[model samples]
Target: MSRRDIVTAIPTSFHADGSLDIEGSRAIFRYVAQSGNEGAFVLGTTGEFPAIDEDEFRALVAAALEDLGGRMRVIVHVGRSSAFEAVRRVEIARELGAREFAALTPYYLASAEGAVESYFEAVSEAVGDGSLFVYVYPKRSGIEVSPALLARLAKLPNVIGAKISEMSLDDIAAYRSVVDDDFVLYTGADRDLVAAGEVGAQGVVSGVSSVLPKPFRALAAAADSGDSETIASAQAAVDDVVRIIGGDMPRMKAALRSMGVADGRSRMALVEPDDEALAEIDRVIAAYR
Candidate 1:
């Protein structure tokens, strides 16, 4: 894989009782590796980050590192609204042998550009060593991290780059324009994978790809090969998968279950797929297959 490539935001597999499934960590990693892409972003929104507790959080990252430690680059998301929690999570991941890390813009309180920058600055300072990827998700974070802020933060020795989850091509381009050509700007939205790549996005951090990594993996190949047609077709296929799976992770787990991978379960109170949704998920598997 090129440095500019795809890395999935893998789902945190859980058992029926809503506990962290350690074995499932290796299971998910094997699936991603077989899909032809290396690297992953664990415990992001797709992994139900805020929903899972600290102990559960630590166990999952430990499991991912133990499973994919030497084989693939694992960048774990260690950001919550609380700066203290983010610091604690980073410390734990680093200790577990997690090599790279990423963080969402802080939530539940102030999310202004400066406030969010301050939150990441503190996180980088907390780590005080390794580089970190700042996750830019305005919808959940409740604030947009502007390109200017990203550029400023990227100047920090520990702030390597960012994972821009938003979908503005101009915004992504703006980020690329400021940072070094090699600066990592990972795309979070799968629909814009090709376009974002065109704008110099270095890699992808996708949620939908977790259920089925093959298509996104292929899309990444097309992007790397500069095959526009294949990229478009793969994007269309992923959009179809997204349409079937929707944003509901329980439904994504359902689709993964159909593929004989994940166990098709989620945390407490997460809505399961309705009959129509299940049927659509089945359609996605069969069509994609």
Candidate 2:
């Protein structure tokens, strides 16, 4: 596997009453920077972007850039259900000096290939000189960003890369085949980091890394060095951590709280982990620590 960058898809911080916790979010960004990961992908799926309003979104973006902009790269996710709204987000981040941005395909209503292409065309234009990453999460967006579509989008000068989610290694390889060698690809699958690298993905935008970064960092190192023993160990650790968290917003926040990072509440309606599950999550964190 080639050297792979690990960018954490950090969660948003919210108080129990479902309000944005700007300070807590700043602390979370600070923690990601201190953890030695390559960068932070903020206001992403893990951050619960859909639930956050415009004001809350702006505050989160400002807080993340303020905290991590100088220390590391910060990819702001400006994906929204409408092209106009997505462009507005791009403008907001650009004003804050954000250079890299990712936007998912328009969600909720089904979008045809033409509409999707137009949407990205508008967003790429808005990004102008800044870098734009096409975020393809078909499961949530209900839109498939086919390799063919991506090939066309790649023609846009600033449409530099993509962060692919819920797709197979073969699917990613297909994506790689259609684009130029310099076109970057980052897998959203935390467990397949090494395999994705093998298939030409340059990195992973990992939600799991937001909480347990050590194992992911260790895995990246092991892959780079071809250390089979360490790779196996790190991969096992990552799988276990993902299983414990299970992509639950509440559970991830709970794990963050266990690490003394931030509050364990979500604006989205989600069930808090039971005591037994929470105990297991703590054990998982401690083992990695």
Candidate 3:
């Protein structure tokens, strides 16, 4: 645990023509590696994963592994709503030196009673990577991974952890009751990091941490040491920054741009923020900077 558990859900950098910005992506990876983050979860929601092509995904994976130089962990999000495609990305990422992998239940299909478990077993067993963290994102995947399912998956030798997106602390407590202390849990929601730490979340797979890695690490440190005042202060700062970015992915891009880290262009489907939102993001980023 400690700060070694902080995982940044790093955003994929993109150019204006909607292509992969390899160096920009490298900048993100470099930032995390230097800022004390222990892991990078690429190609997740903030990365606009659904909008990128397979070739671009491959490039990003290579960039992460190469840049990190084994200094930190890189967990690639290989889920594609198709087991075959997800497995394909896992194979590709493994070929590029990605050691850890993560995935979610099929997004567009109705998984059978045991289909979810079967799908993950197939992928993890196929890749045979060091560890696998199943992503629990009901909103995007449209599939729910019940606590029973999670408990079962915890038994899988290679299935070491999970990236829980929206579970409340109570839900996390329920998961703890089922799985062992060795089963690591990461909160995908930054706003809940402090409470999650109190409820046994080992780390965070945070989108905001891509911009504010230092404070995120501080929050984890305080939580680890039971410093309630520091946790409250750290969470307030993160919440202020999150509110400024709101739900706009592009604002996250702009936040990075404020730090001179990215071009701020996502995929073709995503656009930059409006003048109002852009101004707000800059103002808040200035405060953090």
Candidate 4:
């Protein structure tokens, strides 16, 4: 398997007042490293990279490396509006000992496939390393990266794989059918873990992993081991909690609170899940457990 295997998405750690809690963030990295899972992902959607500044990003990388103690591979997301800034971050991140990089297409406005390709190429050249993976989340970024475009970009010596969040199952299968099997294929949607795995997804970067790492790990293992029943049970467990939390970061945040991990406060502009949402999430988690 490639080094970029199943990676758990990082969670946005916040204080009661909804400020970045570096200590809490470090604790999360440590927890995932020791959770019997492969490793943890940083600066992905759940990490709220869009809201964090460069300093916070550096701090996150530094703290995760310290807490992880080199036990797991660190895949840092470097997507940003300014290509220069993204490239600079990747260079510094490598110096910090991050082995892999994942970056999404630039946001704010959609661009042509050629522009997206050029943007990623610039990042790869700036880092002077071809060991990076592209993050594809058209649903959130307003950029639809066609499989043809991905196939074209994959030609880059450093671009290794693509992490897709939205697409029909048939589209995913079709993309997989066309791409080199050795190229990594990951799903950003956590609830589709089983189906994704079954359809030849090499790994997943799931928001659920921040709070329910064990369950996600179990589900992946079940799928990998061909244990359909186990996969079903685990998927049901994930679906249960996701339904209460509203099935995204909000739900994942509430799950952390239910498990007494994160403080249940998202950064400003993104507050804690409402009381009803939290109560419903708790009820569902309790039933599942």
The TM-score, computed over Cα atoms with residue i paired to residue i, of candidate 2 is 0.97
Q: List the residue pairs that clash in candidate 1.
A: none
Number of backbone-clashing residue pairs for each candidate, in the order shown: 0, 0, 0, 2
> Which parts of model 3 have CA positions greater than 4 angstroms off?
1-4
What lDDT tens digits, residue by residue, belong to model 4 across residues 1-289?
2222457787768777767888778767776777655666788887888888878888889888787747777788888866887887888777777768888888878688888888898887765653788888877888888778888878787878778887766667866876897888887777776677657677777766666566666666666666678768877877765555533676676676677765546774665567787787777667654
User: Which predicted model would earn the best TM-score?
Assistant: 2
TM-score of each: 0.90, 0.97, 0.92, 0.89
1 or 4, which is superior by lDDT? 1
**Model 2 lDDT, residue 208, Cα:** 82
Q: Which ranges in model 1 have alpha carbons more than 4 Å from their true place?
A: 1-3, 224-228
User: How would you order the candidates by TM-score, starting with the best?
Assistant: 2, 3, 1, 4
lDDT of each: 0.78, 0.90, 0.79, 0.74
Model 3 whole-model lDDT (C-alpha atoms): 0.79
Q: Which model is ahead, 2 or 4, in terms of lDDT?
A: 2
Model 4 residue pairs with clashes? 130-158, 245-251
RMSD for all candidates, in order, please: 2.2, 1.1, 2.0, 2.6
lDDT of 3 by residue, 1-289 (tens): 4433777777778787776788888887887778777778888887788887889888888888888756778888888888888889988888888778888778877676488888888787866846888888887777888889999988876888888887678877787778888788988877777777668777778887778766677677777777778778877887887687644577778888878887757774656788998788787777775
lDDT of 4 at 259: 74
